[model samples]
Every structure is written in structure tokens, then in C-alpha cells.
Target: MIITVPIELPQEIIEEIVQLTKQRIKEEQSHQTKVNEIPPYPTRKQLKQILKIGDSRLNNWIMNGLKTIPFGKETRFDREDVKQFLNDLKI
Candidate 1:
């Protein structure tokens, strides 16, 4: 046996859904802003000094994504992100 269901949503329901979607998007963007608040760039040496880790361990951490170290054509680290990562470690 087959059951029939309504094909179209009511206008009010659609509007509510749209509003909720927008609200959720706004919230997500704000959360991203907070996460992205990490600071200016720093070199690998500086980062290693700041975190007090050896080259191998630092490389491993970067590989594991414990910190937001960017790689590729440009090697850079956000200072604030490093600080935040360190701060997060205190917990």
C-alpha cells in the first residue's frame, strides 16, 4: 500500500523555515568569527620558541592539526591561534 502526502509547504511555514535558516547562518558566521580571531603570522622558529617544543614534535603537532599551522606555498602561523591553542591546553 502507498500513502499520499502534501506536496507543498504552507507559506507561513516556508517563511519560518527561511527565517530559521538565516538565523542559523548568522550564528554560524559569528562562531567562525570567534574561531578566526587568531592573530598575525609568525615564522616556524618563533612558533617553536613560543610553544617550547622541538622541531620533530612541532612538525607532528602541525601534522595532527592540534594547532592551526598553515603550510604549502606559504609557511605561516597565526600568533593568536598559537596563543589560543596554548591557552586551550591549560584546560
Candidate 2:
């Protein structure tokens, strides 16, 4: 069930509310744009599962040339980077 309440406001107040709503929409769009710029970097555990590789194998790849972005104590790899790394490998 839905309920509706009737309220009255001055014309100026209504106009101000509409303008504020537009401003809020613009702010949300800007925030969304920034969020979209972030890369989908997978954690080490996730990468291991995705690639079906063990710890030693993953470490070996990292030692060779697999690029990793370290965030403090955690390591992450971009999806595209991992794809490129696999493509570069002849096997």
C-alpha cells in the first residue's frame, strides 16, 4: 500500500527545490565519472583462483615480468595486464 501527503509551499521555494535537485544530479554524475575511471585490479588470491596457479607459480611469474601494483602489504594486478602477460607468453 502507498500513502500520499498533501503539502503547500511558496512558488519561490518550489523553484529553489527544483534547482537544488538539478545540482545534486550533476554532482552525482561527476562522482560516477570518477568511480568509472578506477581499474578493476584483482588481489593475489583472486588472481591465483582465476589463473588456477599455485603460490610458487604465481611468485615465479611475478619474478619474471608479471607487473603488480602494490597497495601497502597487498598486491593487485589489472585484468588487461594479466591478459597481455599471457598473450606475450608463446605457450
Candidate 3:
């Protein structure tokens, strides 16, 4: 056996809940858009251009443990791996 009851929430509370849900969905969509924009493997020139890092800085980062992936005739960087490597460097 089960019992059921119906309750009503204050209108302001309901509106707040709806607004928060919309905000959360908007944030998720924005994040997805940004994530989708990045290629899984970006070439050296593309990476440098996007990140605005010069050759010596890129070399220093690689020396400090940044990694590269070979893509056919050129070298590329894994987007996720690069993100993790840089995040790990944060103080």
C-alpha cells in the first residue's frame, strides 16, 4: 500500500527553480560548443597560433614534459593531454 499527497511550491520558488535550470542548460551548451571547437590533434603551428606561444616558450614547455603526437609528416599535440599538462603546471 502507498499514500500520495500533492503540495504546491511558492510561485517565486518555482520561478527561481526554472530560471536556474535554464541557466544550467545554457552553461552546458556553451561548454559543449567550446569543447567541440578544439581539434583532437592540433599541429605545431596551429597550437602556437591559438595559444600565442613562441618557439622558445613551446620548446621550454616540451622540455618540462609537454608531449607531442606524430601526425603523418608533421607533429601534433593532443588537446586533452596538453590541457592536463598545463593544468598540472599551475601553482
Candidate 4:
């Protein structure tokens, strides 16, 4: 058995609770976004397989702060991004 009582709340108080809940949700979303925004860190062996390049060349690129876009469903790299990166390197 359970007892239930419906108590009326002041309109302002109800609105304030709703506002606070919305603020809490927004704060959580902001925190999650920051947490998920991590930079990529590719390994030497993996890089050799994916790029199908020589270790010497891959090592050269990796040492210079080269990284991929944040990985999603699959490991993907944009050719244009690579071009821009290489252009920046002047190599």
C-alpha cells in the first residue's frame, strides 16, 4: 500500500525548479563535450600499416606533432588535412 498526496507548489517555485534542472542538463552536456574532445595519438607500428610507408618516413612525420582527426567508427584521415600538414612542414 502507498499513500500519495498532491501538494500545490507556488508558480515561481515550480518555474525556478524547472530552470535549475535545465541549467544542470546544460552543465552536464558541456562537461561531456570537453571530456570527449581528446587528441589523437597514433603508434609507430599502426602508422606503418595504415599509411603503407617506410618506417623512416613515418617516423619523420610522427615526430613532428602529426596527428589524425579524432577517430570515430573507423580510423580515417583526410587527404586535404594531410596536404595542409605537409605544406606546413614545407616538405
Of the candidates shown, which would achieve the greatest TM-score relative to the real structure?
3
Which segments of candidate 4 are over 4 A away from where they belong? 1-6, 41-91
Steric overlap count per candidate: 0, 0, 0, 0
What local lDDT does model 4 show for residue 31? 48
**Of the candidates numbered 1 and 3, which has the greater TM-score value?**
3
Superposition TM-score, candidate 2 onto the true structure: 0.54
On lDDT, the candidate that comes out on top is: 3
Ranking by lDDT: 3, 2, 1, 4
Ranking by TM-score: 3, 2, 1, 4
- Enumerate residue pairs that collide in model 4: none
How far off is residue 72 in model 1, in Å? Answer: 6.9
Model 3: per-residue lDDT, tens digit, 1-91? 2322246877777677777778998986775565445578988887777666898988898899889887799988898977777678778
Q: Per-residue lDDT tens digits of candidate 1, residues 1-91?
A: 2323356877778777777778998986775564455347766776665445688986786775655545776568776666566556564
Instruction: Name model 1 segments beyond 4 Å from true.
Output: 1-39, 67-74
Per-prediction TM-score, please? 0.42, 0.54, 0.57, 0.37
Poorly placed runs, candidate 3 (over 4 Å): 1-37
For 1-91, candidate 4 gives per-residue lDDT tens digits of 2322367888787777777778998986774454233224444444455445786885577567555555664444444454455558653
Instruction: Score each candidate by Cα lDDT.
Output: 0.64, 0.75, 0.76, 0.56
